[model samples]
Target: MSVKKALISVSDKTGLIPFARRLVAAGVQIISTGGTASLLKAEGVPVIGISEVTGFPEILDGRVKTLHPNIHSGLLAVRDSEAHVQQLKDLGIETIDLVVVNLYPFKETIAKPDVTYEDAIENIDIGGPTMLRSAAKNHAFVSVVVDAADYEKVAEEIEANGDTTLETRRKLAAKVFRHTAAYDALISRYLSEQVGELLPESYTVTYEKAQDLRYGENPHQRAAFYREPLSDQLSIGNASQLQGKELSYNNINDADAALAIVREFAEPAVVAIKHSNPCGVGIGADIRSAYQKAYEADPVSIFGGIVAANRPIDRDTALAMKEIFLEIIIAPDFTEEALAVLAEKKNLRLLRISALNEPAKKVDNLFRVAPVAGGALIQDFDYKQLEENEIQVVTDRKPSEEEMAQLKFAWKVVKHVKSNAILLAKDNMTIGVGAGQMNRVGAAKIAIEQAGALASGAVMASDAFFPMGDTVEAAAKAGITAIIQPGGSIRDQESIDACNRAGIAMIFTGTRHFKH
Candidate 1:
């Protein structure tokens, strides 16, 4: 039983070559299916095709090759049971010591726009899952490997100890179950979109372990990131920091806001975000021009803020950004010279990502999670994207053409900010933002105070309905001429009355954008 029999099949052939060679040198009987069998044979490893072992020709495009008793019974048998051993001997089945399999590319197959229904159906791997589950259920006797990245690790373990530990086998079994579950989740979520019915509530998702950070939002807490299998989305979860230190939970949260906001502009743009709100944003001719305008929009608030840009970073743009002490900088690409310049500030995080790679659009009303005492809370994320027709103006004066631009910009900026947020905008740039305040009025006061003389001609945007007339009064006193907010509070009439009395025009969007 020196280096007994093992099965290998994978869609991701990352480290399989060297690993298969090592197992061959150890005298393992290599059995594989379809492309994997051909690949191992090409590498000079002695390999047998599953068709040979199963005595069944690969029919229907090689889908029915590995579903026989000879393959699965070996993996599923209990090694220590006399009956299991006698049954295997009676059936002429060799014991399989290992099963390495990664599922078919169902998710990747559907990612193409023109994939046919038959194509998707063909990728639904039946034999692969059967093999994975059979090995996982008999973990005490067989080791299972789902990730190609695990091949080298398992090889190393066997080389060092002559066998994989029971603990390692159990851990690998856990990974196999997770892999099958995630594969099933993709199939279910995809089919749900096809027929438009009540998607069967049975679904699952898998996230690969990314890393354990020093802390979560605070230094005393513990945190780790699990990256989703869908790597095409434009989330901070997909971002790779190319330089500097690891990101804190707060860094990821704020950087996500910055990236989302910068992606909105049709032209080149820059957005500086703090506390999940855009402290400043601008659309201009070049990166430097946009960065300058955004910086001037709210210099005080931009301190230590995360910056996102829509264009490739150049030497001039990086040089201008170097003048500011920022927490993070993100762009699609950074020139070699620019990276060298940015490398000077070793603590600042630099992230590079393609804009086209983000999700097609935000899936509205997705699940939102919040931790609570002794339990956790989950609900739908905010689904309020305002349209011009949904806006109801209550005052006699329609907003001036100039004021309308600022109002729209502020409204968009406030949506990404933490709840109880207030944003003031002028000339399409945020002049001040008050975020994470305990109450609406407190947030309004902070924004106005930050604006100071700048508030005289600014427009204000709020995340939700103001609970009282005091917040409106505060905005008016600070010289805000126009305001946008969700009008669903109990005292909405009073707030509207206060705005009308102050000669400030107000619009009700009937939408709430609460980030927290």
Candidate 2:
């Protein structure tokens, strides 16, 4: 194959002039549209206008320029077939051996703070995608270029071998389809938001790779991080890594879990996470005491775990953290002494996320998406908080004021735990947590055992209703005085009867917080 004619149209003109110059020097005719043609001609590049090739003036505000049969047939026709070549000759259509195009800035335009719907709709590129798709579909003969980063390689290939190789064209075609798919997904997501459809008739999500991690959950697995550009919520993706080496996949996951649990409190709070489960949590008068209490709740589990705080880390907290080995520490800000002290630990991952102080909004519209074997599952975020009126006393005994406070705190912590999950709390701090167990009773037993003597007066919270009376029996044996759960299981009455017999106070939230 030999280079003959090329069509170039782009919104981003980086490296366009030099690329077009190289093509022109190699005896390839340059045909362009609007701004691209004007710029090339100004630079003495000898470009032919698109209207000259199609013999039709651009109409409808330049939206109807490149949709003619002359353009499509030139790009889509089979080059080696007798019928296709004859039809091209009979129709006086020239073959377009190359196409260089990029879509309009729809994502960038919609990302503005106050962009209107009309503004976004107008920026959607129709002719660009149409031409690129046609060229990509016929990539057996026509080479399609969508990214400026490929300019040097493409130009060198053409200059070296007169035309791009079949392998190169196939790769470019695949790239074109992926690019268009992501573009369409962005349009779909934005329109769905405008129409107030959290999940549309057809849902598609697109993400860009942020970085390649050292490994996934294990050292043998490969992994990378991807991020959604439209997400506004405070998340690990947006956190600023102030220090430390590249974070592993497990580190990112654990840090995210810690941040989510820490955000559940309005007052100064600290949460320690290990293996995507909260090992300890505390809310107190100051950040130092909160961290101290959280660490003391389960000092053995806090080793090498990620810690997140909902307040600025002061000098005292830093001093306490320096005494232990921690993988990561994230907070809204750090005092001068704290940062200096933390900086001493060269390998500790330190992240500063400003959104930690800002309250979460758009609860009703936010979604959490998880991928499965065949497809994905999409559901609304579990932002439900424990309201005073929503709590109902189901057992004969009512929780005391102090017990009620601990029950509410435990409920919030339980929401972030994996099912079957159990949490024990006293004085607004988590004493023990058991997560991701196969059975409810197993989770209860693990939590009770971890609490040890602390379980004597601590309140217990279950992420879901107890399926049997065994969990209630176990809690009662451990001297758990108060229990909080959704209370809608088929064996709910059995558990209630067991609690009453043990003289334990129990409350029903009527809302399950299953986090699996």
Candidate 3:
């Protein structure tokens, strides 16, 4: 089929002029609308205004330009059907053989800091999506393009064979649907949030591909990373990789866990993560001391783990880190001397996230999504923390000021641990962590065993309420002084009685942090 007429309308005009010249050189008449037409004419390219093709002036601020039957019939007419061709001839409409279009900057507009609702509404391109859908629906007869990156491929094909191949048109048609679906989804999400409807009856979300990882959790599984558009949180997605090898699936997961824990601290802190669980966490006067405390927390587990720090790394800290086989070291910044010292280990990944220093902000619209067999579980991100007034001492003896501080520190770290979790902390450092066990007592026993002699005088934290008093008994036996847990279980009195019997101080925060 020979190329006859092509419509070109796009917001992103990256390669527009050259591609349009290629189309014009092929003897194809070009029809354009609004700014596209003006730009083409000024660039010495022959162009026909959209009104000339439709014989109707654009109305409603250019919203009613392409909805007319003249444009739709031109795109929808079947070239090989005698009846379709006859219908177009009866209406005196020329067939549109090609369509080049991209939607408005809706995503970019809403991403602005001070974008108004009116501005966002006005930027939603009604005609562009309509024409693209119409063209894509009839892709068997009309070639459709929605991405500027595809201009060269379409231009070369038209220059060679006068039309895109059937396979190319089919692929472009599929891409058009995806593009429009994502655009509409973004608009739907923004409007829903404006009206205070976060999770509507029908939920839709979109993410752009970041990279394809080497493998997933295991070497046999495939994996890739997708990031939300305009993510403002202090996250792994926003971190800059200063050095080292590309991140694998496990590397990204562990790094994210380490980052999340490190963000919980405002002071200088360090968190070491292994297999998506924090093995050690420490708060200190500086980055170097924090790292030392964290390493001493669990020296065995710190090997080959991902380390995240809330402060910049210096030469002394980097020197101490070089002695171990760490997979990744993430910090706010790295001094020149520190970077040079750490560069000796070529395979170590170093990520710098400046947002670590920024104060934490509340994000109401963010959600945590986990996939199941055939669906997903969605919930708001866990940003809940207990205020000082919210803590209730259920035991006969109240926790000392120092023990209360340690309890608060343990509570923060415990929330990030897996289900059935137990943590032992003292002196602003986690001495032992027992996570992902089957029962509360079992978790406490593991934690107590890890802490050994250190368990004496240390505090314990549980992610959820104990179903029985065995966990408190175990904590008392381990010489733990105070404990913190959400107290809502039916057998909560049993645990309280056990704490009173052992003179252990226990506080209820009335909240559960079950991470699964």
Best by TM-score: 3
Q: What are the models' TM-scores? A: 0.87, 0.95, 0.97
In the range 1-516, model 2's lDDT, one tens digit per residue, is 887999999999999999999999888999999998999999999988999999999999998999999999999999999999999999999999999999999999998999999999999999999999999999999999999988888899899998999999999999999999999989988888888987877888888878999889999999999888766547888888888878889999999888878888888999999999999999999999899889988999999999999999988899999999999999998888998999999999899898786644446656788989998899987878778898889999999999998998899899999999999998778898989999999999899999999999999999999998999999999999999999988888999999999999999999998888
Cα lDDT, model 1, residue 304: 92
lDDT of 3: 0.92
Candidate 1 regions off by >4 Å?
Answer: 13-17, 41-44, 156-162, 197-200, 210-212, 231-233, 237-242, 282-289, 314-316, 334-340, 356-385
Task: Using TM-score as the measure, name the better of candidate 1 and candidate 3.
Answer: 3
Pick the lDDT winner.
Answer: 3
Candidate 2 segments exceeding 4 Å error: none
Instruction: Give candidate 2's TM-score.
Output: 0.95
Root-mean-square deviation of every model: 3.3, 2.0, 1.3
Against the reference, the lDDT scores of all candidates come to 0.82, 0.91, 0.92
- lDDT against true structure, model 2: 0.91
